[model samples]
Target chain A: MSFRGAVVTFPGSNCDRDMAVALEAVSGVPAIRVWHGDAELPADLDFIALPGGFSYGDYLRSGAMAARSPVMQSVIEAARRGVPVLGVCNGFQVLTEAGLLPGALMRNASQHFICRNVKLKVENSQSLFTAGYSAGQILSIPVAHHDGNYFADDATLDRLEGEGRVAFRYAETVNGSARDIAGVLNEAGNVLGMMPHPERAIEDALGSSDGRALFESAIRSLVEA
Target chain B: MKVRIHVSLKPGVLDPQGRAIHHALEGLGFEGVNDVRAGREIELDVDDSVSDEALDAMCKQLLANMVIENYRIERVAA
Candidate 1:
């Protein structure tokens, strides 16, 4: 069976094409490009992607406006229905804003718009989006954002740690994220949000293909299930 | 009804923007600045029928992210 996915494009989204291309490369099928204004998602989608980039001009806050937009409501519902969702960078912000994920992405402690490739440790390879990697494996990925500092209450952080919901953690401190967390999964493990752009690093020509494993993992989970 | 919402990062969350501003102020020879924190203020002219619960809901749902920020609403006129 062919894999089905959709990459939502918001008004300021710039990485939607990259995400779509990466999804197609992994699934061997063209992924649907969705619009933020659309209230309904393409039905029966195995995967949904919230790609990186400034949405709503980063107004009020990054990903804040787009999180409340019409399309995200449907995306949130689909996630609740067991469809896997991936949110990178601004998409991560949207998920948190939509209450689909815990914690928040605050301004970087350095107060700079950081843009660079960083190493992330595969903390939990059991989730749908990360099963392709081994536990504690360090993978180089790209991160670019002004507000990637992850903030959560100590109790929530402890809970996430105890439940093994922390999907990826930074090998070194790239931002002031709590416990160096880079990616996280919901309690159900169906939604994954990360500060790094896996789509940006999926192509070997682009420098790092470690990110390819995430897309492949999602596809594999859908196909085998 | 006129209302103002003030949003600020929860205590213990580092505010680098505020720190930088504090440094800049010190560079200009201003003293006695014990601390600095950054926040935003949003003013709204809502209908008279809008209740306190509705205003609080808006803050919790959209105006503020409770995880890292807090919001206070003050109604000037109704």
Candidate 2:
């Protein structure tokens, strides 16, 4: 059976196409496009991606409106059923707002939008999303956002770290995130949310193939399971 | 009925936008500005029959994110 994936698109989503293309290239299957208003996903989807961009123009808060959209309700149910969900950049903010992940993505402490490639250390190699990366391996991924700084209480941070739920950590401080967290996995290890754009780094044309392994690993896990 | 909701970040939560505005005021030579914190105000028009419990539910569910912010609701006679 071929790998099946879907990419959700919101009004201001710019990276949905890139995420679909990346999934298609890596999984050898066409990705279904789902709009934010749709109440359900395509049947039997192996992966669902919430790509980057200013959904709802970042109004009220980053991802606040999008998180409450019609489609996210279905996505939340699907994620609970064990389907893999990957949220990138603004999508990360959505997941947090939707309560799929703990904490909030607040504005950078510097109060300036940051756009650059930053180094990330793979912190958990056991998650479905990070199995292809070795623990402690540093890779460069592009991060561009005004509200990417991660914040949670100390106890929540400690719990996430102790439970091996932190998937990636910034090798250097880029956005003033608490504890330099770049990415995290849900308790079930199926849902992953990260600020960096791995989809943007998946090919040599982008000057990096560091992100290809992430897609490849998801596809591999789907096929093997 | 008219209701006013004031949503403010929790005291311990960092307010980056508010901090930036404070710095801008300082740059403009505004002296002795003790502190600055930013919050939001929302007004709602509702039926006179709407109950207090229902309005509180609205604030708890959507008008405020309790994790980092608190909200005050005021009801005004229409």
Candidate 3:
């Protein structure tokens, strides 16, 4: 069966096309485009992606408004049902705001919008998202955002680490995230949220093909299941 | 009713914007300032029919992020 990936687009979502293209390039199936205002998601979706962008113009807070949008209700339900969901950058922020994940993305420590490629180490290669990479493998991916500082209480941080839920960590100090976490998986291991734009790094021509493996990993998991 | 919601970063949570404001204050030679933390104030003009519980729920659900910030709701005479 062809991969049924859906890319959700909010009013200010800028990377929806990139996410769709990445999914299509790897899965050989066009990703269904979902609007933020819609109350329902495409049925039987194999994957759902919340691409990076300043949804609702980052009003009130980044991803805060978008998280409460009509469609996120369905997305949240879909995620809870064990459907694979990947939220990148602002999408990551939304996932946190929606309570699908723990922690919050705050302003960068430098108080500047950082845009560049940073090195990330695969912390857990067992989840559906990171299975394509080996543990401790360092991959360079691009990140661009003003609020990517990940913050969680000490107890919560410990729990996330203890549970092998920290999927990726920054190899270098790119943001002021606690323990330099770049990506994380929910307790169920099906939902993944990350700050780096893996969708932008699907090919070597774009500086690195490291992100292709992320999409490949999701596809491979479905095929094996 | 005039309701105001004050949202401030919880203590111990780093506030980069507040720090930046502090640096600017120091650069301007403002003295005796121990520290600076930033917060937001949102005023809502709601009908008297809106209950306190509804206002608190609004603060919790949308006006303030409960993770890194705390919000206090104040009702003032219009």
Best by DockQ: 3
For candidate 1, what is the lDDT? Answer: 0.93
Model 3, A1-225: lDDT tens digits are 678999999999999999999999999999999999999998999999999999999999999999999999999999999999999999999999999999999999998899999999999999999999999999999999999999999999999999999999999988899999989999999999999999999999999999999999999999789
TM-score of chain A of each: 0.99, 0.98, 0.99
Candidate 2 residue spans exceeding 4 A from truth: none
Task: Give the TM-score of candidate 3 (chain A).
Answer: 0.99
Record all residue pairs in model 2 with backbone atoms less than 3 Å apart, i.e. clashing: none
lDDT of 2: 0.91
Model 1 chain A, poorest ten-residue lDDT window?
A106-115
What fraction of the genuine interface contacts, i.e. the true contacts, does candidate 3 reproduce? 1.00
Over the stretch A50-169, how does candidate 2's per-residue lDDT look in tens digits?
Answer: 999999999877888899999999999999999999999999988988889999898898888999999999999988888999999999889899999899888999999999999999
DockQ of 1: 0.87
Misplaced by over 4 Å in model 1 are none
Top candidate on lDDT is 3
lDDT of 1 by residue, A62-95 (tens): 8899999999989999999999999999999999
Q: After superposition, how far is residue A172 of candidate 1 from its true place, in Å?
A: 1.4
Model 3 misplaced regions, further than 4 Å: none
Can you write out model 3's per-residue Cα lDDT over B1-78, one digit (the tens) per residue? 899899999999999999999999999999989899999999999999999999989989999999999999999999
